[model samples]
Target: MILLEWILFLFLFLGLVFLMGKYMSSVYLGEDTFFTVIGKPLENLIYKTSGINPAEEMNWKQYGLNLVIFNLLGCLVVFLLQVIQGYLPLNPIHAANVHWDLALNTAISFMTNTNWQSYSGESTLTWLVQMLGLTVQNFLSAATGMAAMVAMLRGFTRKETDKIGNFWVDLTRGTVYILIPLSILFSVFLISQGVLQTFHPYQHFYTMENQSQVLPTGPVASQVAIKQLGSNGGGFFGVNSAHPFENPNGLTNIFEMAAILFLPLALVLSFGYMVGNIKQGLAFLISMLVILLLGTGIVWWAEMLGNPLLIKYGIAHGVSMEGVESRFGVLISSFWGLLTTATSNGSVNSMHDSLMPITTLVYMFNMGVGEVVFGGVGVGIIGMLYYALLVMFLAGLMIGRTPEFLGKKLGPREMYLSVIALLVPPILMLIFAAIALMIPSTVGCMNNSSAHGLSELLYAFLSGAGNNGSAFAGLNTNTLYYNFSLGITMFISRFVTILPALAIGGSLAEKKSIPESSATFPTTGILFIAMLIAVVIIMGSLTFFPVFTMGPLLDHLFMIHGKVY
Candidate 1:
């Protein structure tokens, strides 16, 4: 039954993503779409009202500048909203204003599309701030990523051009045309599945034991719809998708999981369409699928194996379902854990910290590779393509030929930028994880001792730096040290990685394509996919193998000897 469920999910997801890719390409190229009639008028209204000229294009510098300024404004607005949330309207629960440091952390977190929460949602934010601030950033942040990806894709498709499309236009079209309509439909569908969509006060109830319970409710369905769809995994409720109101049943669970992966997969197909080669996109998609499938399989098997210590203690469980919601069980929870981290959608239906050590290792590996295995919506596809360039450069050297990709020669300027982009996340994850481990204040935040604790710190840094919001959940990161440090890591990772890729795109756009000859390397084939996969894995493993040894790898070995952390 579990295998059938997995197969069904994969089949439906692939089919939907192919059609979605074609639709999104039509939207990008100014062709009519299903939402054309509705989307066009709203898009125009946004432009007219905001004083934006949709036809004007931008060079790479202008595009980057616009993106930075817009996000800065968004950061400022969100910070203000949080600091004054206590005084704001629609505070039925009357949550207090956030402290300055935490507010700043959150502002940057949401703005950068890394929704790492230092505070619990229900207790810290009012309905007003949740809607006006956090939820609003969810749309814009995701659109920003999509815009950047489209610009990068434009870099590949265009020849002898300085412009890489207008950032404002791409941002507006992505939000108004694609994100909004899908969110609305998803919100309605979630409501049908018993996910809450309301502004009513918390309901008080009593159990048979006369224990008091307060059931929190808000406009969850709306937030959840985009949170999953956009790969902006900021849950309205603090426990995230694990909460019943957020991810109610098996059907809703499946929908949210599917939603998490939908855009990332579609963007792959859209890449093929834009470049006029579906097979090229399929190769990229297949590589991602292979990695994701293997990662998921490992997690599922480990979790199902149960804990050795527990089995020795005569617990007698068939498969360990610890820290998982009973409704979803082990299979779905394992799937969600791998999918969420793989896509950099950090929302969780299960506690990652409670997974078997081997399962945690897979989780860490997925994010450690910069989440390029179907990564966060727009960023993942572009990041993988960037890696593809690097792999081609390496392959060319191995085969004793000059490297070229998509008809553009891999020159020093492009190669240097690509190498830097590839190095940023792992370097940041390592440097910061090392610093945290060395510092007393940061080390004291660990929820467990030794290997498990090291995993916690490493996971936090990797998750933040990768712009993947999932955590091990054991680390207490609300301290002044962690909040500030992780915030900086998230900020640097989001922009540093993106700007370089965009810069390369701009550079590539200016070069005229060299026509394919007998020497041209084929990127859309089994060989390319294998090389890409190997490069991604080897690059990740080589950089972080020691850290893995200190954490999940050690924890697994120790547990086998009945020395569990």
Candidate 2:
């Protein structure tokens, strides 16, 4: 029955991917979509009011500049809101201003679409800040990533053209047509599933045991909808999806898991359509799906194996349910853990700190691989394309020919940028993590000692650098040092890769596309899929394996010997 549930979920998810992918392609390609009826008018209204000329396109440099400026402005607004949130309206519970460091970390996190929350939402922010600051950035940040992706795709499909597409146009179309509509529908679904949406303050009541309890409530349903849809996974509550109000039931759990991957996966199909080759997109989609499934399976197996120390003492059953929600159990929790990390949608339904060591390793590896296993909405496909370029270059060298993908020849400039984009995250993750471990103040942040402590610190920077927001839950990341260090990591990891990708897109746009020939390697086949998977693994393993041996791998061996850390 459990296996059947997994099968059904995958089937429904793929169906949605196909339908949504086709629709998104039409929307971005400037074709008249069904959304055009309403979306077109709204899009025009936004442009007219904002003085944006939708028809005026931009080169990669111009597009990137506008994107960065817009995000920085949004970040500023969010930071200011947090600093003075106590002065803002709708503070039913009188939430005070956020500390500058946490506020800065958060602003950058959401602006980059990372959404790594150093502070809990319900207690730290008012409803106004939630809606005005975080929720608004949720939409814009997601649109920013989608716009970057569409611009990069334009690089591949167009030749000898400096202009890709207008950033303002793509940004408007994505938010107005894609994100807003989907969020509305998903919000309704969530509200129906018992997720809370209200302006009421915290409710105090006595439980059956006569103990007072506070029930936190506010605009949770609306935020939860986009947090999943936009791959912005900051929780309205500290416990995130684990809280009953955020994810109320098994059905909600299943749907939210699917929602996390929906856009990222659909965009893969959209890539195929945009580039005029469905098979090519499928190859990328399949490679991602294969990795996601394999990782989830490993997590399931590890969690099911349970804790050896507990089993030896005969205190409980073999299955590890220490921090898992009984409502979802091991099967769903493990799947959610892997899926959330894989897609850079970092909402969690269970405590990751309590998972088996090997399961945590799988979660870290998901982010360590740069979250390209169905990554974030627009960025996932973009990251995968970098790997695609690298594979093409490698195949070219083997065959003694110039490597080309989708007819564009891979040159030194493109390859250099691709290497930088691919290497920056892992390198930063390691460097910052090493720096943190050496500082006694930073070392004090760990909730556990030995190998598990190493995993905690490693996971924090990994989450930041990969733009993944989930944490090990055992680290005290709210401190000044962590907030500032992780903030820097998030900023560098996001733009360092993004700027290079844009430069590569610009370079590709200026070149003439080579004609396909008998010697040209086919990207749409089992061979290509296998090679892509191999390259992803090799790249990830080469960078992350040494750390894995010290952290999760060592912890797992210790667990086997009945040593708990």
Candidate 3:
């Protein structure tokens, strides 16, 4: 316990420490004001879009209204494409038009960065529709997430303001200046790795096996770009990152994993930069890392161990090389599962359904953590900060000392809102998962395997609601029940946490950045990050542990004993 606590401080808490140092550097390095860093780019965007200057500040209502309208238009546009895909060209699979409910749900899903796919990619979306609808939303949703985070940071840094930068301005800069350029380079590089980017239809080529060879292709590079850039984990093909054309090589694997995590990781820098308090960002990043690493290490190690049952049945151990994608080895696959759930990339290379029972639970628990470690695009770091403020406030209250973070006082209003933001996703996950487990109609998903199989169904709900998008490959997830379940999860995952985050950002922006005092929690130092880690673990374990235990723990033990249930 003590050792685990230290690990949290060193890696997770180090973020806080780094933030202080980084904040100092931001202070001394450029002498640039916040407006310059944020405002100038926004000004350029305003010119390009409306041919007008938004130099004057706007009210929260105006800012929020624009964001809502913009996203709704996006939703309508994306939904139309899917419903009208039969009319589009380059559809080799002759994909049919999507139904109304599914189309609306999908549109909203992509618009929100949830990307909870209910259909197979190759057979569902036409090449044009894929690019127009799903692919486009990937970028927009990611930009939205980044914008939200920036808004929250503005709140923490500002002394008094009704505005938290222009939402349109921040969204524009994050997408054009940052996400686009990086995604373009990444797409070209992925092409070098043999990932397809052409409009060519599914190709059939001869192989030595003399068997019919079916190959799927499309504008993969475009979708792949924002999937990572926006922290939106939706994949182009049905099998997602598992498809050879989508992730063709190991280096590409490394790059995609990095893309999936880069901004989420870079967000540490952004937070510290915005607040003029580096430690705060670092502390959030470090605490997130501590939780992420522990989750990753356990999943990796468990998967590497192979199932004890398989070993007893004379199955090979060390690495179950046969069950995973040959293009990327088990090591890479484990890394992807770790990275994807840790962020929001839902694409799967290896079959997670095929993984050992214990391993599957680890993956879901990662989702349960609520993506705080350099979390999906804008979401993760911001989410972590809310909780960080919560802990700081509680700690302050306990000692009868005023809670000060960076320069702002931690008060009841901020604390309540942050807690609400933090609680929504996890609560939704547990309630939905529990419902599915207990309800026979929902539990029909467990048609094949034992309690282990049942575990996969629960995992999908957890992943979807968490907006992580990966799945337990064991189930035949093509039914109406799953489609609807996944849709609900995606919606809740994105919007539930988003509203609270926005509110918090709005509140924080009104306050001014305060100077550190005796009562100020040294978040950047090891201690606070450790506290954050404890909070995450306790919350995660208590929240999901019992359900996970019934779903996987006993099932794993049973599978090992050959009881099979």
lDDT of each: 0.88, 0.90, 0.72
Per residue, candidate 2 scores C-alpha lDDT tens digits across 263-306 of: 99899999999999999999998899898878877887888788
Poorly placed runs, candidate 3 (over 4 Å): 1-47, 50-53, 476-478
lDDT of 3 by residue, 477-516 (tens): 5556566666676776676666666776677667767666
- Residue pairs in collision within model 1: none
What's the CA error at residue 402 for candidate 2, in Å? 0.9
lDDT of 1 by residue, 334-435 (tens): 889898888978899988888888998998898888889889878988789879999899989988998998878878888898888878878977888888
Poorly placed runs, candidate 1 (over 4 Å):
1-9
Candidate ranking (TM-score, best to worst) = 2, 1, 3
Off by over 4 Å in 2: 1-6, 313-316
Candidate with better TM-score, 1 vs 3 = 1
Q: Each prediction's TM-score against the native?
A: 0.98, 0.98, 0.89
